[model samples]
Target: MLKNDQKVFVLLENNNPQVESLSKQLEIPLITQKQIDSHRDGFFLAWRDNKLALFDIKSPKKGMSVEFDARSMEQPSWPAPKTGTLAQAIGKKTKTVVDATAGWGQDSFHVFRMGYQIVSIERSKIMAALLGDGFERLGNQSWIQQLNLKSPKLIVGNAIEILQNLEYIPDCIYLDPMFPAKRKKSALAKKPLVVLKGIVGEDEDKKDLFACALQVAGKRVVVKSPNYAEPLGGKPDLSFAGKLVRYDVYFKT
Candidate 1:
């Protein structure tokens, strides 16, 4: 259930059956863009520029959408070469990964582009819908079609429960739970993360989720956390530090 302050509605400009169906399925109101004024402080879901996007009422002009393409402006190439901190954390030998906390799906998509089999799990209905739409778009990309590439499989449910019931054991279980900012700073947080926090709240049970991942992961469990925050599952077997985040890996003996 959504928080009182995080009310979300679906915006339909015309007789869009697909949007209408999505609104019904999500149990959110379907309204026109004009109607958005009434819910001036709420967030909205709409199709903008041929992609499903989430718009905050405060900044409707700057909506957030999932994109599988390379994020760096300098690197316009698709399927960026996987030789970074994330790849190091996931390990060179890891073939299958289960992203147990796939918020926004940026990490999962990155790993997928690296040719690793990925399964993404998202609990929020809104995030799941956005991810589903993004994956569908990824599947239709010319490069993806020509190479017969498949997008990461998405599973919508509580990760604590889903991790235990996975049909196949994955080589690595990755967790990137939301952690509170270390200190209040002058710079505003990223729009996508701010909007996501408002909608999904924080992951208070991340430790429990980490514990569960340890039990189910075939080889190792990787927990991504703010560099300043304490590790979720005690001391890690190895830790890889990035610019603002760290990946703590716990190997299964």
Candidate 2:
């Protein structure tokens, strides 16, 4: 559910019934293409090639929509999961994980694909809606059906509050709190990252989030941060490195 002040609405090319149905499901206004032209300012959820997506009309170019794809599952061979990346970070020891900051859910998706019972939490209503759509798309894939894969349960709220009230603790708590951009030229140009930054803003309470995650996790809390940002909750018990990101693992004493 979105805040009353949220300007998001459903953009339709015509009086399409599917769009109307989806609008009701999303609980937003249904507007025509002409309405979109007039209100080309805020964000809107629309159908692009029969797939639901969230797009910002403020972007520089057109046809820019934020949708999710499990790249690791789709193309397993090339750019495969690295040795010390997400898979290995929560591999043998971590049975269940709670991803506290599930942005686009790509990391959460890959973590789930690696066979961890995972749950995700996102505070932004817009991001949560997009993530819901993404998970739905992933569940509908033929391979997912053959393998009988289900989407990770999503909890839409401030994770700092939700993590504190969990019924049962998980083996690991994963945090990928958003920080100000520090990447190179190419990484900054990526669509989802660019769009997410524009929409979600920075995680001001990330340290508190790490502290709360530390309280409920059974085994450890894994904080994903750029190598330069320092550890989220001071020094980590162990650390694993990726191309640009690193997982700072804090084991429960």
For residues 145-182, what per-residue lDDT tens digits would candidate 2 score against the true structure?
66666778999999989998999999999999876666
RMSD of 2: 3.7
- Kindly report which residue pairs in candidate 1 clash with one another: none
Residue runs of model 2 more than 4 Å from their true location after superposition: 1-7, 18-31, 38-40, 60-82, 183-189
TM-score for all models, in order of appearance: 0.92, 0.83
Tens digits of per-residue lDDT for model 1, 71-161? 4323435456679888888998999999999989999988887878999999888999999988998887767777777878999989999
Least lDDT summed over 10 consecutive residues: which range in candidate 1? 69-78
Off by over 4 Å in 1: 1-6, 70-81, 185-188
